[model samples]
Target: FGKENPLKANEWVRTFGATAGDPEGARLNLWAPAEARSAGGKSEIGYWGMELGRMLVESEQMPVCLINGAVGGTRIDQHQRNVADPEDVRTIYGRLLWRVRAAGLTHGIRAILWHQGENDQGADGPTGGFGYETYEKYFVSLAGDWKRDYPNVQRYYAFQIWPKSCAMGVNGSDNRLRDVQRRLPRLFSNLTVIATLGVKPPGGCHFPAAGYAQFAGYLHPLMRQQLYGHARTASEFPGLQRAYFVSQRRDEVVLEFDQPMQWSDSLMNQFFLAGQSGLVQSGAVEGNRVILKLREPAAGTSITYLDSARWNPENLLIGVNGLAALTFCDVPIDEQ
Candidate 1:
């Protein structure tokens, strides 16, 4: 395989296979099992993969293959392996490489879709919760190693860790992990962290079947914009750009977005200002911008939107495209 033989890696290009009822042409495998089920029936339906592949094939008018090597309840550490040890097939990372070789996909790996970190946030396990800094270290290392092994893979997409049902303190820690995920793009240019704010989890930590399908709905448009470059309008995927104080009084802080604002009254309620007084009040949206009215001078204040440690059924800072605005905190008001 590619691990033992460097020349074999070049053979991982597009290949064709013929199966029952399917023609002898290039086809994308929806998931590893082809059933789109995982984690003891607590995982997504792989609608995202199927829809993404469909978009690519239809838009480009070419055949493309999509494969999944994801396993539920696995921590980032479980996937982080020693790339130098080619014979070490102990981790999921090793198994992933083996699967790639088995599938004869050594030539190209366009992108990797990652949705993990829930298991890492748990309190009990060998790979239990860690600080954001530590989590970032592990994740960056993992991505770097994967890219090193699969040189054809240039882009990595990951879903932000969604809200979970945990103790208040644990929830806070999980939010920090989510923040780490959000900042991953800053660390790695090829990485894009998809927001999972509006998608509600069905029960413990898994998205419902409907949630998975809806998540695919959100991802498809993003892929169109980010990957295919079809939707060139900002209205397709609204995201926060910068936040700063617009007034010398420091009472009002303005939030700027990548797209035009479609402000709603309910979205205004989601904004919060944390100052020395703990939780300050917020104000209404004004013309594609959110104004935060602090109770006091915002010298040491931080503005956060949809920043909840626990599940909030009413968190509604959605973009015009129906995707939720990413949770963010901008402080040092004068520095903007």
Candidate 2:
């Protein structure tokens, strides 16, 4: 197996060196739903990770090791539950999430790979389990909660239910299942749904073997698309939405966005400050927009934001951008 190992080390540095690495690639962690570890045996889940990892090397990007977080026979609600779900390994997503949070690497999360729904397709008729509304409720909440949790994790949900290959009309004739798939992404800002309808629908519709992972050819490419899209969206981070009042009396700065934001370092990839004399000072984000106290008290400073179609947390303040001094946000782009 002589592969070029096509990507050279410094090439990444030379090309993307200007930008801050998303919290050191090698050290950044991934959390997903692999089955619970038993005393001596592995869960019956498939081995699609190796295939995924191999394809990644082909992409000219560094090979990233993924942490398995999926479990067997679990459904969608399982992944979104904030409370620990004992049916599947409890608090797994939460535990890894805490560490990622404590490490303060929100931006390090590029995307979440979700392959669920085998358990929910009881049927898809107007009266079937798929027709029920509970899945949608959980999905909508999950999107907001993930934003609330990581603030920087963009998700790519793979709707794993599908076009039944054998006996298409029976076992799991849930067309409504597909409808929900099409609908989930519209409710959240940073989510995308990978339509897996054409893939071989489970023959048993209840369980499938590890070789069933053949669908990765379709599923994995979609995963790549979503990950790249997340990066592009995040680069547009910290676009301000509103500036209610800038007072000269207390030298106070009061800002408001239709969406709420936390000032985390994840948001400050490479921020700068512009002084009145046309001199710009650069900064880093750990809490909020990095700013130096007005050296002259009245030196005066303003902020920056996207005047275009940026996700307006102002609409409801998506998540806080916890940052350090120097990075500033909510700089109102005049509404024209």
User: Best by lDDT, which number?
Assistant: 1
Weakest ten-residue segment in model 2 by summed lDDT: 11-20
TM-score for each candidate, following the candidate numbering: 0.75, 0.44
Pairs of colliding residues, candidate 1: 12-106, 12-107
Error of 1 at 332 (Å): 4.9
Superposed model 1: Cα runs more than 4 Å off: 1-33, 38-47, 58-61, 84-87, 122-129, 165-171, 200-204, 229-237, 275-282, 286-288, 309-311, 329-336
RMSD of each: 8.6, 19.4
Quality of model 2 by C-alpha lDDT? 0.39
Give the per-residue lDDT of model 1 (tens digit) for 19-70.
2121211132322322243332221225555545555566667666655556
User: Which residue runs does candidate 2 get wrong by more than 4 Å?
Assistant: 1-46, 83-89, 95-106, 123-131, 163-173, 200-213, 223-226, 229-336
Total clashing pairs for each candidate: 2, 45
